[model samples]
Target chain A: MAEIVLEGITKRYPDGALAVQDFNLTIADGEFVILVGPSGCGKSTTLNMIAGLEDITEGTLRIDGQVVNDRAPKDRDIAMVFQSYALYPHMNVRDNMGFALRLAKADKAVINAKVEEAARILDLTQHLDRKPANLSGGQRQRVAMGRAIVRDPKAFLMDEPLSNLDAKLRVQMRTQIAALQRRLGTTTVYVTHDQVEAMTLGDRVVVMRGGVVQQVGTPQELYDEPVNLFVAGFIGSPGMNFLAATLEQGSLRTSLGDLPLEDRVRRRLEGRDVPRDLIVGIRPEDFEDAALVDERHTGHTCSATVDVRESVGSDVYVHFTEEGGPAGTAELAELAADSGRADTGMQGHRIVARLSPATRAAEGSPLDLWLDASRIHVFDPATGINLTHPER
Target chain B: MMSHRNRTLTGWGVVNVLVVLYALFPVWWIVALSFKDPSTLSDGNFVPRKWTWENYHGIFQTSEFTRALINSIGIAVIATTIAVVLGTMAAYAVARLRFPGKRLLIGMSLLIAMFPPISLVSPLFNIERVLGIFDTWVGLIIPYMTFSLPLAIYTLSAFFREIPWDLEKAAKVDGATPWQAFRLVIAPLAAPGVFTTGILVFIFCWNDFLFAISLTSTTAARTVPAAIAFFTGSSQFQQPTGSIAAAAVVITVPIVIFVLLFQRRIVAGLTAGAVKG
Candidate 1:
C-alpha cells in the first residue's frame, strides 16, 4: 500500500489555462480520499495528474515516499478505474480481470486464483465468460474495479467511476465500492462532482473550486465549519443560507431580528475586531417554525413571513422573507462581501427553513423563526470566509 | 384498398425491373459473348448460334495469359497487404495519439489520396526506373499503395477511434504496455475496418489497368488487363472479337467468386462509421 502525497502540485495548460494549483494533500495508506468539485473545477485534472495521464506543471508527487514525478502509470504501481470503466470489449470478464496478471507473466494458477477471487468479490463468477458489451453498466463498472483489484496495485485512482450508472445503481455501487475498499484497505483517491458521494465515501474529503483547494476535512467538519462561503454553500444538501448581518454589541442583527449570541459563539467572536457588517451562515435545518420554536433557543428566534412550503414526508421546508437581513439578495456574489450588501439593514429577502414535521407553516403567514445558534456559522461578507473563528 | 395497394406494388415492380435490367444487361452480354463461337461473335447478335469452350481453352494453352494471371494476383495481394498494415498504423495514430500534427497528418494523408493514380504514373515510372523494378510485381505493388493506402487508413482509423478509450486504459492498469494494450484491445475492435479495407484495396488493385499497362511492357510482368490486350492484337486474332470476350469472362469470374465468398466482411460495416459512403 502507498501513502500518496502531493506537494504544491499544479497543472497549467500551454494556453495559460489553470486546471489545478498548489494542491497539497497527503493520503495515508488505506485511506480513501475524495476530490470533490463541480465540472471543470480541476477535480478530474487532479485525478489525471495522479494517474499519470496528464503532465504536472509544478510541484512534486510522491507515492510511498518515492517521488514519482517522471514515472509512467504502469511504473507508478497504480491502477485507475476510469469514468467509462474501460473494459475490453472483446475480452471476457475473467480475461479482463486477469489481463494485468497475465501481462506480469504470472503463473497460470496464480492468474486463475486471483481472477476468481476478484470475480467472486464482485459477484461476477457466473459472468466470467461474458464480454463487456454483454454486461450491464454496473457489471462493467465492477469489471473495471476487478481489473484494478487483481493487480494489487499500491493505490486505486477512481475517476468518477460511478458517474455513468443510473441513480439507484450508483448508490448501490457506491456503498459496495466503499465496502470493498475497506476490505482491501488499499489507498484510494476518488474524484467526483457529487458531494453526497464524497461525503459518504471519503475518509477525508477535499473540496475544490476554480482549481484551488478550498478545504480538506471530514464531511462533518466541512458541514459544521466551512472555512468560506463557497464551502458553506457547497457542502450540505440544501446548502447553508448566507444573510447580511451586523456584528452588534454581544449580538448579531438581521432585518428578521436580533439573534443573541450563544456562549460558545460569543466567545469565538469576542476578541475579533470584525467589520460592523458580516455575512452570517445559517443552515436550513437550523431554522425551525417560529411557532414551534421552544423556549430553550428562543433567544435566537426571528420573525419571518413564509412564502413557500414544501412537505418532504419526514420534514417540511419553508421559504420565507425576513425583516432584518440583506433585501433582495439573489446572487451569491452580493453576499460575498460585507461592504457590498447595499440593503444589509433593510431585510433578508429570501430564506429556506427546515421545520419539524409536526409544525405546519403556510405561505403568507408571518411566523416567528428560531436558529440553533450553537450551530450558526458567521462568515465575512467581504471575503465570504467564516469570520467567527478566523483562527481555525 | 387492395386495388390501390396492388397499383402501388405494380409501380414499384416496374421500377425494380428497369433497375435490374440496367444493372444485368452488360453482364449478360459479356457472358453470352464468352460462350459464342468465332463465327457467332463476328455476327454481333445477343444470342450465339452455338457455344464453345475453345476460347477458354486457348487462355490456358497460352503462356501469356497464365503469366499475367499470376502476376496480377501477386501484385494485388502484396499491395493490399502493405496497404492494410501501413494504413492501420497510420489510422490508429491519427485516431488516438495526441501528437502535435495529428490532425494535419491525417489531413495530408487523405489530401494526397485525391491525386489521381494516372497523374502520378509518369513520376512513378521515373522512380520505378531508378529502383530497377519498372516491369516487376514490386513496381505495381509500390504504385498501387498510392491508391489504396488512403482508403485503408481512413476506414480503419475511424473504427479505432470509435472504440472507447477506457478499454486501453483498463489494459494499462491491468499491467499491459501501450503496445500490448493496442494489440489486445484495439486490434479486435478494428478488425471489421481492416477486413473492409482489405476487400476494397484488393478490388481496386485487381481492376487497376492504367499503371499496370504503362509501367509493365512484357508478358512476364503484365497483368490480366494488359495480357487481355494481346487477344485483340492486330496480328493475333482473325476478327479479334471472340477471344477478347472470352478473356473478359476469365477476368470477371474470379472477382465475382471472391466477392461472393467473402461478401459478409465488405457488407457488414464497409461504411459503418462513415458519414457518407
Candidate 2:
C-alpha cells in the first residue's frame, strides 16, 4: 500500500568492500518487485537496507514520498518474513501472529480478531495454541506469513521465505503467497536466489551481480531479451547455452555451421564498429526436435551427439556436446562460479535442448536439433553487451 | 559372541553400581549417624542399632544453628538473584554486542573462576574487618556473588549464542521497539539459561566454607557448613559428632531436592535448545 523509492543507494563495509552500490529503483504502489541474484550478489543486503535492518551508508530511501533514511525498522511500518521463519519459539501461533498488534498497543479484542482472521486465511486455525517448535516447517512458514498479514503494515519484505520448505511444500506456499499478495494488494519486495521463484512471483524483476544492478524488466522481457551475458545465463533453468562465434560478412561463423544473421540483427550490426568475436545465446526452449519441426520452419539446424536424455512428464531435455570450446568470458566464468558449476574445471560445457516429449533422441547418438534463428541472441564478446539488443 | 555381549553388559553394570556406591556412601553414613542414639554413637557401624531423633531436635533447639541456617538461606538467595541478573546482561552483551575489551573481560572472568579461593581468604579477612562489614550477611554475599558471576556468565552466554537472533530483527520489523523485542522475544528464550545459572550460583553460595568461617567471628553471618565446624556438645568434654551429622543431612536435603526437580531443564539448558535439534 506504499510506494518505495531508493535513490542512489549504496552500502560499503568498513573494509572497503562494497556490498551494494548505487542501487536505485522505484517500486510502484502495490507492485511486487523481486531482487534476484546469486549468492553474495547483495540482493538480501539491499532488502535489509530497505527494511532498515541494515543502515544505508549512502543515498536516500523514501517511502510514500517521505525520506526514511533515519527511521528505525519499527518506525518504518514494514513487516519482514525471514527465511528461517523467525517465529518466537516461546509463543504459540496466536501470540506470534498478534505480536505486532500487541506491540502497537492495539486493543486486545482487535488483536484477537485480526489474528483469528489471519489464522483462517493461512489454514492455521487449528495450530493457534501450538508453539513454533511443535509445528511442521510449512506450518511455521504460514505463521511467519500470518505475522506479516495481521500487522497490515505499509509494505511486506520477504527474504527467501519459502527456501527452507521441502520442494513440494515450497511450490504450494509459493502459489499461496502470490495469491495472498494479489488479494491484499500490498507493496512487496522479495529477495531470492532462485530464478524460478523470481520469475513467477515478481511483477518486475531486478537482476543483480557483484553488488550492481544488471537489468530490470519483467520475467518474459528478461527471458526474451537479457541485456548481457550474466542475465542470459542466470535467468533460466538449465540456463541459456552459450557458444563462441565470429561475426563475418552477411553470415555468422559458429562451431555448428555458417548461418545468416536475422534481418534485425544484421541491420543493427551495419555501419557499426562491432567486434568480430561474438557469443551466441540460445535458450533451451529455442531448440526443438528436428523431426517435430516442419521443413518450411526449420531455418537452422545443428547436429550433436546426445549425452543424456531426461523426460520430465511434460517435455524431454536432450543434453548434448557440440564440437566447440565453451564461451570464454569473465561474465560466464563468474556465473559458473556463482552456481558452483566451476568446481570441476576440466569438464567442457553442456548444451541442453528442450524437445517435445515425442523426441526419440537417444543417448550417445547423433541428433538433429532445429534452432529458431530469430530467437538467438548475439553478444559482443569483449564487452558482454547484447549486440542485437532491441533497445540499442 | 552372545557370551561376549553378556560379559560387556555385566562389566558396565558393575562399573555403574560402583559409581553409585562411591557417590552415595558418605551421604548414607551421615544420615545413619544422624539417627544413631547418643549411647551407641561411638559404634562406627554402617547401620545404627537403635535410631533416635534426639540429634535433630537438639540442633533445631539451639539458636546458633537456627540463626546460621537463616543467614545461609538469606545470603545465598540474595547473592544468586543479583549474580544471575548481572550475569544475564553481561552474557547477552558478550554474545551479541561488539565492544572493546570484550575478550579481556571473558579472559579475566575465566581466570577468576580458576583462582584458588584460599589465597584470597587472608586478604579478604583483613579488608572486611577494616570495612566494618565483617560478621554480617553482606560480607558473605559479596564474595559469593563475585565468585559465582563468572560461572553464570559463561553458562548463560553459551545459551544466548544458541538463540536465533533473527527473531529479534523479525520482532523489530513487526513493529516492536528494541526494548520490546528483548522483553518479549529475547528474555523468554533466555529464561532456562538464567534459571540454571541461578541454581548453580545458589549452590556455590550455600556450600561456601573458607570465607564464611574466616570472615565471620560469630553465628551472625556464619552459614551451615561453617557453623557445623563450631558445633559443641552439651558437656565441655563431649563430642559434637551427632549434631554435626544431623546438620549435614539437613543442609543436603534442599540441594538434592532442587537437582531432582530441575534435572531435565538443567540438562536442556546446558545443551542449548536453539535450533530444531
Candidate 3:
C-alpha cells in the first residue's frame, strides 16, 4: 500500500566495486515491479538496498513520500521473502507466520487469527503445527509467503523466492503469488533472473545490466520495442534472433536475403548518421513457413537448410545457420557469455523461427521461410542501440 | 561354517565388547571398592568379597566431604553458565562480523586451549593469593572458565556458521531488533551447541585436580577430586581407600548423568553443521 522511490541509488563496496550505479525508479502505489537480469547484474543488490540489508552508497529511498535512507528494515515496515525461504527452522508453521506480530507483542488471539488466515490463504492450514524441515519445498515456500502476508506490511521484497522450487511448483506458486498480490494490493518489488517470471509477474519490469539500468517499461513494451540489443535478447524465451547485415541502396543485405526496408523504417534510418553495417533483430514468431504463408501478404523470403526442428505441440521451432557470421557486437558477445552460449564454437549465425506446427519443415532439409519485415528491428552494430526504435 | 557377513559381524561384535569392557572395567572396580568393607579393600576379587554401605555413610557423615561436594557443584555450574554465555556471544561475533584481527583472535583462543594447564597452575596460584581469592570459589571458577571458554567458542562458532545468514535478515525484516532477532530466533536454534558446550565445560571444571588441589589450601574451594586426596581413615595408620573410592564414585555420577541426559544432543551437535539439510 506504499509507493517506493529510489533516487539515484548507488551501492559501492569497501573494495571500490560498484555493485549498483545510480539506480532510479519510482514504483507507484501497490504496483508489482520486477528487477530482472542475469547473475551478478546488481538486481539483488538493488533489492537489498531497498530492504535496508545493504547500505546505500549515494541515494535517497523514499517510502510513502518519507525519506528512509537511514531507516532500519524493521522500522521501514517491509517484509522480505528470501531465496532460501529462511523459515525459522526451530518454529513450527504457526509461530513462523506469527513471528512479526509476536515480536510486536500483539495479542495472542489476534496473532493466532492472522496466522490462521494467512495459512488458509497459502493453503497451509493443514501444516500449521509442522516445522519447516517436515514440509516439502513448495510448502516451505508457501510458509515464507505466509510469513510475509501475516504481517500486513507496507511492502514486500522477494529475492528469487521461487527459485528453489521444482519447475511445476514454481509456476504454480508464481500464479498464486500473482493472485495474492492482486488481492492484497501491497507494493511489491521482486528480484529474479528469470525473464519469464519478470514478464508475467510484474506490472513494470526494470531490466538491469552491469550495475546500470537498461530499460524500465511494461513487459509488452520491452518485447515489442526493446531499448537496446540486450533487452531484446533477454526478454523472450527462445530470444530474438540477430543477423548481421550490410545496408545497401536502402535495402539491408543479410544472409537471409536482401530485405527492402519499409517506408516507416527507412524514415527512421534517414538522416541519423546510420552505420552501414547493421544488426537486424527478428522475433522467432515473426518468421513463418513460406508454404503456410498466404500469397496475398508478400514479405521478404529466404531458404536455408534447417539444422534442427523441435515441435512443442503449439508451434514448431526450426533452427538454421545463415552463411553470414553472428551479429558480432560487444553487447551481443556479453549477452552470449551471460547465457553460457559463447564458447559453443558453432560457426555462422544461427537463427530460430517459430512456425506453425502444420509446416513440414524437417532437419537437414532446405525450407523456405517468410519474414515479417515490418516486425524486424534494425540496430547499429557498433552501439548495440536499436536504430528503428530509437525513442524509448 | 560362518558366512562372510556373519564372520564380519562377529568380529565387530567382539571388538565392541572389548571396547565396552576396557572403558567400563575401571568404573565397575571403583563401585566395587566403594562397597567393600574397610578390611577387604585390597582383596584380589573383582567384586567386593563383602559389601557394605559403611564407606558411603562414612563419606557423607564428614563435613569436609559434604562441603567439598557443594563447592564442586557450585563452582562447575557457575563457571559453565558464564563461559557458555560469553562464548556464545564471542563465537557469534567471530562467525558473522568483519572486524580486524578476527583471525588473530581465533588463533589466540586456540593457542590458549592447547596450552598446558599445569604450567599456569603455580603462576595462577600466586596471582590468586595476591588478589585475595586464592582459597575461594572464585579462584577455582576463574581457571575453569579460562580453560573452557575457548572450547565453547570453537564448538558454538561451527554451529553459528552453519545457520543461514538470511535468517537474521529475515528476522530484521520481520520487525525484530538485532537483539530480539538473536534471542528469539538465533539463540533457540543454537540450543544444541550451547548444551553440548555447557556439559563439556561442567565436566572439565568438575574433574580438575591440578589447579584445584594446588590453589586451594582449605575446604573453602576444595572440589571432590582434590578433597579425595586428603581423606583419612578412622585410625592413624589406616589407609582411606574406601572413602576415596566413595568420593570418586560420587563425583563421577554428575558427569555420567549429564552425558546420559544429553547423549543424543551431543552427537547431533558434533555433526550437525557438517552438511546442509
What global local distance difference test value does model 2 have?
A: 0.89
Lowest summed lDDT across 10 adjacent residues in model 2 chain A is found at A295-304
lDDT of 1 by residue, A93-114 (tens): 8987888888889999999999
TM-score of the A chain in candidate 1: the value is 0.91
Clashing pairs in 2: none
Model 2 agreement with the true structure over A144-240: per-residue lDDT tens digits: 9999999888899999998988899999999999999999999999999999999999999999999999999999999988999999999999899
How far off is residue B199 in model 3, in Å?
Answer: 1.1
Note the B-chain TM-score for every model: 0.89, 0.94, 0.95
Candidate 3 residue spans exceeding 4 A from truth: A295-298, A343-348, A390-392, B268-277
Lowest summed-lDDT stretch of 10 residues in model 1 chain B? B268-277
Q: Write the per-residue lDDT of candidate 2 for residues B1-277, one digit (tens) a residue.
A: 9999999999999999999999999989999999999889989899999989999999999898999999999999999999999998999999999899999999999999999999999899899989999999999889899999999999999888888878888988988888788788897888878888888998999898888889999888999999999999999898999999999999998888887887777666432322232
True contacts kept of each: 0.48, 0.57, 0.57
Error of 1 at A235 (Å): 0.7
Q: What DockQ values do the models have? A: 0.39, 0.48, 0.50
On DockQ, who's better, 2 or 3? 3
